[model samples]
Target: MPGASPAALPPAERAAYGRHARTRASRSCHGWFEPAAGRPDPVDVLERQSAARLPELVPIRYGRMLESSFRFYRGAAAIMATDLGSLPHTGLTVQLCGDAHLLNFRLLASPERRLVFDINDFDETHPGPFEWDVKRLAASIVIAGRANGFTPKEQNTAVRACVKAYRRRMRDLAGMRALDVWYALDDADHIRAILSTGTHREEAVRRAGQAAARARTRTHLQAFDKLTRVTAEGRRITPDPPLITPLRDLLTDADAGLRQERQLQSLVEAYARSLSSERRHLLRRYRLVDMARKVVGVGSVGTRCWILLLLGRDEGDPLLLQAKEAQPSVLAPYTDGEQYDNQGRRVVAGQRLMQTAGDIFLGWTRVVGLDGHGRDFYVRQLWDWKGIARPDSMGPDLMALFGRLCGASLARAHARSGDPVAIAAYLGGSDHFDRALAEFAQSYADQNERDFAALTAAGQSGRITAQPM
Candidate 1:
């Protein structure tokens, strides 16, 4: 077990865990009705744990008014479900690309310049109801559609379209050859198939195509302007006003940071040894120029995410790699000890297994920071046309198209790890699960509202420091 990562639990042990998880899924056919084995009440658990976590998590409270635009938006799930605690189905699950909200689906360029659609986030991925994943997607459509001013009728239509498309794709998946499902690439053919079905969103799809076509390695010439200066000197990512800052400003000042930089270099080298030879060779050409502990995303606001500016020959030539702290997925509690212990490796390995062609630089490493607490991180190219259309940016027709694309893409991604044919068979030819999910979506939305309220109330009584919703 020497040098073994947390994910590298002994094969016998790993198999045992998988088996237990599978058994739990089988017994869960009655859903949460029978209560998860040794499970606490969902609401009670949420209030207790999330509240105890304090400023460790987001401290946002609801906006000032009951009728303000913000309050209406406050805690509304991406979709509405009646009760997630219901539903009878298989637990056939995988490390879901967790948090599959509608907006998480996006366009990223494969090394070959082929634009593919896939889940772009993995922070909360872990084993759970494949239905939970769908429930979230369905709800996001309703919530985001409402935000766009879609009429209730239009919103329902959009939500229904999202669900049915998942059903249709699941059916299609049922018939796919194993290799076809495994090796399927979300390439031009996939996008074209979804696009041809609608004329209303033609322009938007074209824009996506154009954006993807333009994605490539962050090259020296083109990226230099954004990265750094050579004003009679060397290269690096230029410090911007508010967003990008030098490593000195944030981590430590002066050569003291250079020492920390060396430590990181050692860590990165330790990381490189874990990859394939081709990747090591590709990595050798780049050296770290600068790094900053930059904040990223709303939910991920407090997580340790560092942007490392890398270079080849000069400051202008830049490649950005983000080394994000990969903590356990939020789904871990529900899953219990039924997952990879090294959550970081789980995230990286799952991404590589799930993504057809991942970033060449994708690698995981462990590092002990100045605090002496070790954290694991998976590093990858920062931005390579990995762009998603804003969920709120689309009108009704476009949102429907986007929803279908999201559903189909999710089905394909899940097919990479689980037997899609089996999942499809479970789904069958009807909309049973679809309707079930809609109910779950509504219920979960209500739950989120309550939880959001709990967080606000906790903050109001001086129990926790929080920003208003």
Candidate 2:
């Protein structure tokens, strides 16, 4: 089968390859996790990342991470990458959500204006062993469960549930036609259906409906109403100090601000080139009115991010876009090296590959000379029916249910880019892999706690500055 592609091979042959993978790394072996004696300091890993980020915002990132162990885990992808790299893997590859914590799975509007549940973040996405993502997600469930004061048994149960869902969903995808697998999407109704099968069916279904309704209200127009103000000159983004500062306020100098504004406009034009012609034409209808530096996400706090306000047709019609900096994935050093010339393009490509549907305005651009240094950025609509889960608000049963949803969603995403047949066969028809991951999740959650304490000590000892938001 030298000339035959993996997808072209018979199902039996694909399953054989999966079974063969167990020789390189056994399924049960994944349960064991002990940090190497010479493991790199987790804080040091974070410091290395901070060197490339804005110095002023680095403290805020630290502050966010110091809030809890789970918060620290969200920002510790690079640390985990090093740990995971130290272990043997099965060599089954997929587009990993390098930071696939439970929170990253959320509700967002698809291109067809339907509220869909899917993986919403891709800053650290790259091709890697499929189990890496499963481990990341499983560990997150344990960590979140701990934060919510769940017993160890409850935490293990949640972790097992998540892994089981991933395994079963991969098996289902394996048996489906390639085109059907590609076309499958987990919409709001589908999520309600899944929730209805759980212990608290009525309550879960009601919450799902509420979440969908809330997401629908989070549109670009809603963002415009909340984040902008009508000034004497025109509509401008309201400044909210460190969290949101318009370019003019940052530059202070009138001449420098004007130059920076012009540069950003040109970058927007460049980003439009990456989109399809139809979307570009639709974009051309709006004119850039304002742009502001914005801080976003627990892990991405210090990176350069901007909110661009564009107005179309009239003052009432507005478009909000976010141009977020794209740094090299935290998984870069551990996995195969860089694959794309522009980091922004790398992010966009991965998102399009894994997501069932994407933002119509999604694109990328590289900026030059604005600050005498070049940087890459990916652009997308600022708001489109977005809703994130609050882990603290969830009980054990609900948390487990959410974990199942995340797991199934993750399996769908990996199936788009990896071999589901091979993965399903590797997982088999038992709970062996699920139990192994549950074990691994507990060990990693313990490691995460140690790392979080190290960060807290760093902050208290004046080794690192932390400014509460």
Candidate 3:
């Protein structure tokens, strides 16, 4: 059957293959978690990653990770990838989110101008076992629960809720037509309708509505107002020191500055070629006004991220785009290597495969001689109605509800690329898989705390610098 395509198989046969997979790795086996003998030092792993990043910005990455165990987990994707690689997997592959932590799931504005809840990050995305993403998400819930002072039982409750939703949603997707599954999406209105059926229906609906409303206000125009100032020359991005430094401020030499600016313009032109004809025409209407190196996110702080400010018709009409560096996925070492030559293309492809609707401006390009080197970057609108979640502020009930939403959303993403029929068959109709994942979540959370301590020790020993932003 190695030569046979699973999608070409009959429904019953595909399910049989799923059941057969249990022989290679049983469902209960997922409950176990212990660092393999002589596991690599977690801090050493971080140091290796920092080696390729901007040296001055690396300390900021450490400072952000040192904030809390949950924050540490957010930055520990590479470390976790090593651990998960040592474990037995189901071999059910999907376009993984690579770092599917709770925070990465958010509300994003679709191309149709509708707000949809989905996975918002793809820097670490690649093809790998589907359980990797689920485990990453489950462990995040447990770690977040601990941060919120939740009891062990309550934490387990939330983990189970998440896994249960994934199982049930996969089952539902298994019964749908292929085209229907591909077209299905979870919009904000649907999210509100789902919340309305919950035990805390009124409160849930109110929260959902408020979040959606807030997301709508986070448009490009809003970003322009907050990030730019009217200068004698024209409107320019306001420099905020280390966090946001304009291109001119970064290059002390006038010649170097002019050269870098030209490189940026070329980068934008290369990225525009990746877009559709209409989108390229739409983008040509805007002129690149300014660019700033911006530090963003807990794990992405050290990466090369640039915010491009473009003016459309006039000073009042503007567009903000983010060109973020795309490195090789953390999952790359654990799974088959990526198919794309450029990491940016790999990211863009994975995102389009998993997301129901994506950023219309999403594209990739390679920039050479920009900073005496070459790098791959994916470009997208900087502020497109994104709604972030605050897990630390959530109560036990709210956490569980949020977990269910994240789980369902993750399942939908997996179904788009992986075999939902096989996955549903493997999950079966019981809570066995859910309970196993819950147990694993607790064990992994303990491991995360230990890793967090290791990083703290490194900082205290002066082995690493941590400069708070």
RMSD of each: 6.9, 1.3, 1.1
lDDT tens digits by residue: candidate 1, 120-218: 877666665566677677767776666577876676677667777877886676566667777777777778778767657576678666656555443
Winning model by lDDT: 3
* Overall lDDT per candidate, in order of appearance: 0.62, 0.91, 0.92
Give the candidates in order of lDDT, highest first: 3, 2, 1
TM-scores for every candidate against the unseen true structure: 0.79, 0.98, 0.98
Better of 1 and 2 by lDDT: 2
Worst 10 residues of 2 by lDDT: 1-10
The parts of candidate 1 lying over 4 Å away from their true place are: 1-89, 199-224, 227-233, 240-243, 251-259, 336-341, 453-469
Error of 3 at 60 (Å): 0.7
Off by over 4 Å in 2: 1-4
lDDT of 2 by residue, 426-467 (tens): 899989999999999999999999999999999999999998
Candidate 2: what lDDT?
Answer: 0.91
TM-score, prediction 3: 0.98
